[model samples]
Target: MKKKVWLSIKGKQQTQDQEAEIIELLTEGELYNKDKSQYILYKESEVSGMEGTTTTVKIEGDQVTIIRLGTTNSHLVFKKGKKKYNRYETPYGDLLMSISTKNVDVEYNEEKDPIAIHLDYNMEIDGAHGSRNTLDIQVKH
Candidate 1:
């Protein structure tokens, strides 16, 4: 079932102590597939620098993968205690970024319905410390 949902994303960069947050109501967002892996699909906003982009969030057990397509493109993998690296493409060029996941917590209902996803990680861009970040995704059904 496709439902109108609100997505609230909070991001914090440790060194700078600057916190950024955005809340978007997505009439096109859908949360489905209880028997297998779950997925969240939504479009990106213009303020985020990816106006025509679509974001796909895939959750399977303890792993989470986020893929972006359209104006900007990147594939991000988050797994507890694991480090993953990928190239992020921008209009300027492609830059390599690494993510070291410290924690991944998924909340689900009794019937295995996904409620939210929270993760904390350290990020590096081109082998330089980027930020210590936390991302919380709330699914409002």
Candidate 2:
């Protein structure tokens, strides 16, 4: 069964020569579980610069993957102590992005649903030093 859920996201990005940039968002989405994996489906907001895109977050064990489609397309995977790369396509152009994951923390509710997830990773864009980023997300029923 699919459940309606609310998502609260807090993101921080720190890059060399720049102070930390923080982004916070609150949105509603659908959450479901299948094959022992949890999935969240949500629409991208204009504030995120991808108004027409749909975003899906998949969580399985210690790995997390985010896939975005529509106005922009990208697939990113985060696994602790591992690195993954992908291409991000936007209206402007396509950019190469990589994520070197530092940590993945997930907290679950008594019902076996995820209540919170935190990710710490270093991101590189276009082969340039990008930023150290952290994403803290809280899922609410």
Candidate 3:
């Protein structure tokens, strides 16, 4: 059993809000299965004065590759490609944004009553500026 977690980012320059929603839409609807793969969707919103833009990103494969989709210049678009594990520099700090064999790691801790999954992501964005975004996801079943 596996689940899909969706993260959305919104707000204005210098300040951005990141929200993540996890949904179990698989047939088993469980979260601690080692045989299943999890799906991830990420989105970011940027606002400048009275205008704003939102970008949606998707990551597939068993931590092999990452796919991103969004809009540029107010037009819908998709970025289909693959990149080796790498890091970039940003306003907040240094970031390593990659979806490779060793980039995205998921661990299941069963010491608690319900299992928990921990995700750590270090990434960067280009706009008027860039900021470091960090998120923690814990799921109980």
Q: Which candidate is the best by TM-score?
A: 2
TM-scores, each model vs. reference? 0.85, 0.96, 0.29
- 2 or 3, which is superior by TM-score? 2
Q: Write model 2 residue lDDT over 1-141, tens digit each, in one string.
A: 999999998889999999998988899999999999999889989777789999999999999999999999999999999999999999999999999999999999999898999999999999997899999989998
Q: Provide the lDDT at 10 for model 1.
A: 53
lDDT for each residue of candidate 1 in 43-134, tens digit (9 for 90 to 100): 88865668788988899999998899987899999999999999998878998999999999999878676678898999998998578888
Q: In terms of TM-score, how similar is model 1 to the real structure? A: 0.85
Deviation of model 2 at 14, angstroms: 1.1
Q: Per-residue CA lDDT of candidate 3, range 1-141, in tens?
A: 334433322212122454433332211122222334343323333332211322222222323222333332221111223333444433445444442121343444463222222223333333222333223333334
In TM-score terms, candidate 2 sits at 0.96
Worst 10 residues of 2 by lDDT: 41-50
| Higher-ranked by lDDT: 1 or 2 | 2
Which segments of candidate 1 are over 4 A away from where they belong? 1-4, 16-28
Predictions in order: lDDT: 0.80, 0.93, 0.30
